[model samples]
Target: MISGLLLLVLVGSAMAQRDLSVDCGSDGWVTVHWRPGLGFSQTLDQSKALLGTCPPSSLMSEDTLLFRVLVRDCGFIQQVMEGRVTYSNMLIYARRPELPIITQLVKCDYDSPVGEESEFSAEEPDENREQETFNMEIMNPDFSGPAPSLRFGLGSSIPIRATVEPRSHRSLRIYMKSCEFATDADIRRATQVHPIIANAGCLMESKSGNSSFLPRRHSDEMRLYLEAFRFALGQKIFLHCDLEACVVRSLNVDRKACHYVPEKRRWTLLDEPSQSYACACCDSTCPRTGLMIDGVSVHKVLGPLVIVENEPESSGSPDSRASSAHGMSASRVWLLVFVVALALVTVMGVLVISYYLCFWRGGRLGYRPSRDLLTKY
Candidate 1:
């Protein structure tokens, strides 16, 4: 019964959507729209979708894109379009954005180099370029400015801007590979193994700084917006990004990768540069996700990296098979007491009835003694 109730709640809590269109091609684009309350039409983009953008390469390989849009706005898009607009051969996902933000890890499609390798926004670059290495800087969420520390409560959206150095007057392309919630254990395990977990959720990709100065060596920066509401109080967050400098030998090459350096106490270039990661990093499974941590099995459904407090020791145990003695629960003990009291009451009532029938009503013992005494008198 409990399982059924849980299933119902899960289904009911699912995000609702108005499917504008069903089938979409890989190379095709999708136009998503939503009406939150009355007549407000919400404008959406590719970054809000689960699979991000499905390009020609993806559709060609997968045949068709199984697409669905959120029936409301998710508070990610800023533009407003009148009603919902439909495009030729494009998929649609429209929904209301009324769900609470939590530490949720949403599944996203894998990153691929599908689009043409050109300057972002179609501006041609000069032939003579001689910059070798570049740097990435996160411009948004400001990182407490000079303090170099960042702290935010739940339900806060983190907008990331990673700028490349040598400054390309044009824009630079940024590709986000993965984003996930992890603990110190998970991070440690992942570092030991090559290639991070591929199936992690909340993936996004976009271009940045297209309309900057020209004749510069650096490309445009990459911007990533992450909405964190369901994260644990102190859990670590990890982000991975790949920056493409240019298409070389039919490949998108990144001369310098970017990641947060722990030892330096700042986000800078190191031997192992990742897209982004929190200070308290881990790579192990959480105990509440039905995984055993430190030889303890946890059966509860806690969010990612959530700390379990006052947990039980062996919640369900069986040890009374051989022995006759078994501990009774509180309810069982109360039931036993009630049954014994009822049995005693029934026995007393039967005894009273027998006494009335034999001694009082039938006069079996009283009449003989009285007759002998009266005859003597």
Candidate 2:
């Protein structure tokens, strides 16, 4: 027995040594630190830290574990590093803006090589690289100032390029606002019309102060392209020309305001509104009948139309339906009260009967205790 107890104690002691700690700090920006193996740890901020410790002597089940930390918008613009710790390795990840921003890597003094190096050596800096400039006058400039203004269609596709150091990863983002509109009543009368203002094939390439516009084509494809272009132009006019950024691989067009009916069935275009047919049945069978905007037969019995009208002063709006609902709620409340009262009365009746049996009778049914028997007890 003593030997078994000793073995158990040794096993318990071995289990207590496994744990992990994750430390987090922020100066101008956020920094996360991971201590050598405990189990798992994550820190959103120094004040808010998450530390996980496993049971002692637990075998390493998984090598890598993913954790998420949320930071409410902090306006301080900088890259934040998140740290992770495992049994044999420590890892750090960084988060930056969605758009392209300058990133700098600060090497640690005690950094050691992790793997074998390749045979290729880094390239020397190019001294003969020359910059080019273009001087094309704006035809219909919108504004005349230090920065000249040039107009581009709402749906014009522009090419973007970026140069970064070799073996380095960089991201570029551009934001743009697009608008589209159509005024042709025939097109408007169609199932749905998406205006096109600029052809998608139109290409604009830009570099520092040197920009070039590709040749334009007015072919049949270009005519089809105008449909999309007109739509974008209409949306821009509707929004009053909101300025937007042009991000790489990020082209988003906002058309949240446009409302077009679903294309379930085609709508007929009517020439005369007076010639529309009326429902033959009365209020119950067919409540109303009207022509849809596209002149399709719309029977109100199939779907009711909701209308809001101003109330008159004379007819003081007494919501009889609301009052009826309140009455029903009050009836339910009274029913609950009656049920509770009946239950209370039932419990009191049972208690009185029990008291009478225990005190009035000498543990015998329909029998009363005599005075002499009571005196002897």
Candidate 3:
């Protein structure tokens, strides 16, 4: 989904309707540029990207052959999508101020650096600090930005990346204590919760499926991707997570996320492989984190995400879903018509045979002229 959205934001290829061409096939940051507009149609392809006169700040050059440099980086509209930020603008090209010939869609996708403020937008960085220097939030699969209220297919995996920013407390390591899908964001009542990670940090579902913590890159960051599921059919779910920033001194039993490794025949610590013995209690009861450096347990809520029962069979577009549904409806109509036609043909054949036997052949319905025993005399 991220990749697909990025495609529109960053035009990967150059599409031209006529002499004038708009292209964003640059190396990085997606620099969309335009060539000289000469011998172009007066009424341009409305979809063609057009850049008007170059701004004073933009790099402008005047060639002897009556041409001017046109470029822009800012004036575009800023839009936020699923997880990433997109900058979009449509430029109208017209010699006459009142007339618009060509229209060009110019844009670029803002990707967050590996582990930096990827949570923040390209234009604005939202630190989103809570509970005294501690922070917890959901990041997109790319770890690019915040993922809020996104839609997911039921069977697909949601890369739930939860990270802790223990500002001055670098010695603290983050752990996934517990997580669940709840109908309500509050999740106060136990009846409303469908547990995903239980018993401190043990992935209870891992014994049967692929819900486990990913290997940690930094002590402050932890990612747990989940095979998407819902609390109810066609209902939205919220991820209610409890995270702990335990003071990291040495690797031990209680401070880790564990999942059952079927082949290894035991439970395993996500970050520490050799310390699988520490996760032995995952099958039953596991102790919680002992020392808290910040004395704050992060309760992160991410979603209102839609978990759909079936995804569109088409390659991958929302429009394809509607088209696929219409296709199915058409096929069913044709099938009904065929059945009705077949039934009609069978009835007609039966009627024709009955008439032949009763009137002409007279086999079963033969009426013999009995001897005039009484009536003729």
After superposition on all CA atoms, how large is the RMSD of candidate 2?
32.6
Best by lDDT: 3
Model 2 alpha-carbon drift over 4 Å, by segment: 1-24, 28-174, 182-241, 245-377
Model 1: residue 77 alpha-carbon error in angstroms? 33
Lowest-sum lDDT 10-residue window in model 2: 1-10
What lDDT tens digits, residue by residue, belong to model 1 across residues 1-377?
Answer: 00100000111123553322232223323232222111235433322233222212222111122334331212111111132111211122222323221111111111221233212211223358544233333322432222122343343334444444434443333222233344433455543222321211112111111111111122344443343334344544443333333321111111222332235533322112322221111121111111111110111111122222221111111122212223346568889999999999999999999999987987855545567677887
TM-score of every candidate relative to the true structure: 0.24, 0.16, 0.46
Name the candidate, 2 or 3, with the larger TM-score value: 3
TM value for model 2: 0.16
Candidate 3 off by > 4 Å: 1-135, 189-191, 288-295, 312-377
Question: Candidate 1, which segments miss by more than 4 Å at Cα?
Answer: 1-148, 166-172, 179-181, 184-219, 247-377
Please give the lDDT score at residue 333 for candidate 1.
Answer: 86
Please rank every candidate by TM-score, starting with the best: 3, 1, 2
Q: Rate the local accuracy (lDDT) of all candidates.
A: 0.28, 0.22, 0.54
Query: Regarding lDDT, does 1 or 2 come out ahead?
Result: 1
lDDT of model number 1: 0.28
